[model samples]
Target: MEEFNINSVQVILWKTMENLIEDDFKKFKNHLKVMKDVPLSKLEKADRDDTVELIVQTYTEEFAGKTVVNILKQMNLNQMANDLQEKVLKIELQPMLEKQKAFEDARRAYEQREEQIKTQAKYAEKQINKGYKKFDQALQDEVAAKIAALREEEEQKSQMMKEKIEKMNREISALSDTMRAIEEKMRSDDVTPPQF
Candidate 1:
């Protein structure tokens, strides 16, 4: 059997209890004592909500609802009891039913949101990976260009050095020829000595 909500029924009873004058309230409290004995001093101090709570405590929710209704009818509050009895079914089912409905609605909304996030995340991941790949390719191109430029500069240096070596060899050859000519002239002068 489904456990109907007790608090809603308790509130209904409390509302009915509110209509009672002081004497009637006292009568109602006395009637509650007949149902279940507690300290009268405790009952005296208790207000409408407290009285309903006490009844619900003494008897469970179902028994308490019936008990309050019978007590009201006994007190010549038949119209109020009739009105309340009609509300009893509504109050018990409505709040709990609405709560279940709300829970189901929330569950559906959450599932839809989860799917939306998953779809969006996939698109985002693909775009980001493409961007990173492009960036990596750019870096590779830049590194390769720099390496080729440095190699070309080194080749130019080697070519310049070879040209300089050839020029130095020509200058050494011209000096050697001049030294031979001077030696030949000195020998001719020595052989011809005569007057200075």
Candidate 2:
């Protein structure tokens, strides 16, 4: 629990009153009247200099009648007003200001988070594209390999068929020559049969 300070309102009142002209004391009193319910401790930090000076000056003056003392009394009343203003400053205004600051901070945090999400999304997209490219290249490589293997197998089969055909042709030509030689020999033997 934070302990609340009670004298800030008085200080504030004094400061506010200090800046005003002497003739404005009556108006200043009206302003103070409006703030009658505000705690003096809250207004401790408030400007009461105006009221203070008015009181001191009025009291010190050699006036025509009891009016002088009465004016001085108004300045005394400022003392009480100041006390409440101080309290309000510490308990109310300060906390309000701090809350405002926190809200601003939260807003900034949200903005930063949004920016980070965007950055992450962009990075993810890049990675996805990169992965797709890699996958596509792998698929292409696989297809090329398969095609090459099929072509190699076809070439091997064609070469084997060609070799087999050439070998068959050579065997057939040798068989034909051998058969003609045998026929020639057999005819020669028959022609010589009467000499035997």
TM-score of every candidate relative to the true structure: 0.44, 0.43
Which residue runs of candidate 1 sit more than 4 Å off their true CA positions?
A: 1-91, 173-196
Residue 143 miss distance in model 2 (angstroms): 2.6
CA lDDT of each candidate? 0.80, 0.57
lDDT of 2: 0.57
Clashes per candidate (backbone, < 3 Å): 0, 56
- Deviation in Å, model 2, residue 165 alpha carbon: 4.9
Which residue runs of candidate 2 sit more than 4 Å off their true CA positions? 1-7, 13-94, 165-196
lDDT string for model 1 (71-176, tens) is 8888887887788888886766786789999999999999999999999999999999999999999999999899889889888988888888878887777876
Model 2 clash tally? 56
Residue by residue across 109-131, what tens digits does model 2's lDDT show?
99999999999999999999999
Residue 97 lDDT (model 2): 82
